[model samples]
Target: MPMPASYPTYVPRKQFTQYLDDYVSHFKISPRYHRSVESANYDEGTRKWYVKVRNVSSDEIEEYHGRFLVVATGETTDAFIPEVEGLNSFTGEVLHTTQVQIGKGI
Candidate 1:
């Protein structure tokens, strides 16, 4: 299918990442990095949620309480594919987005 002239038809991976970085920097979106999530639990009595976060560098665990939460991890990842039956009969190989090759003869 042909894309509209205003939209992009093909964009390189590095260029795409650079565009995303530029967007973040322009908008001043400072995202926290390397804060591992240990567990998330909800309390019915208080009607709030507790998230246990552990610092990746210090290994210190701290609990954060919030009424609402959104897990925004894996913004550039492909959707999860569930297991299927008779996968051995497939002729084509499966590859993730990161594993896709670009440019040249392709």
Candidate 2:
């Protein structure tokens, strides 16, 4: 489905999340959220990926086996600020892309 014309060229995070939720619901995709991966290893003998995940809320650990494993680290998971010569000398404010909030401009 095409996005609405009211959406801007660059959709906001909340809008994008809602779109993803709608797509998941429409496709009947069951994705796990708020789970921390403790370990992921591929067994050569079984030829399968074994993943150990812990639920953040319940602190329960579960093991899952899959033929294919996809690791998706979000774009803004880590903020990187390159070290430039004389960058500290500037008195102006410096902000990273991850630190910028919607509707707030520097």
Candidate 3:
């Protein structure tokens, strides 16, 4: 999705977060946070996507059907750091993509 014109060229972390919150609220999008997808399968006959999601907190599983299913992992979940030779010896700072703050010398 294109960024809104009102957004500054270098949007701050909080501002970007607020923009997302506003967009979701304005669009009445229902996002299920903290839920893990157990399975996702597309049905050609019905042309719909069937997905099974499990709530991480309550351990409850639920089924959902939709025209589209988005799998957005990684950034919402834990950051993975692969082991590299001499990484510990390096003096430079290491930050994940999600940890980067725009216009802050990232």
Local distance difference test scores for all models? 0.61, 0.72, 0.70
State residue 59's C-alpha deviation in candidate 1, in Å. 0.8
Q: Judging by lDDT, tell me the better candidate of 1 and 3.
A: 3
* lDDT per residue (tens digit) for residues 1-106 in model 3: 3457788888899988987788688669898888888876667688777889999999999999987654443565577666654457644455665675433434
lDDT of 2: 0.72
Best by TM-score: 3
TM-score of each: 0.44, 0.50, 0.63
**Cα lDDT of model 1 by residue, 1-106, tens digit:** 1222443657667766766677677669776678988876666678766889998988999788877544554556665443443335534353444553332111
Residue pairs with backbone overlap in model 2: none
lDDT of 2 by residue, 1-106 (tens): 4555687889898988887777678669789889999987767678777889999999999899986665555575587766644447644355666776533433
- Would you list the clashing residue pairs of candidate 3? none
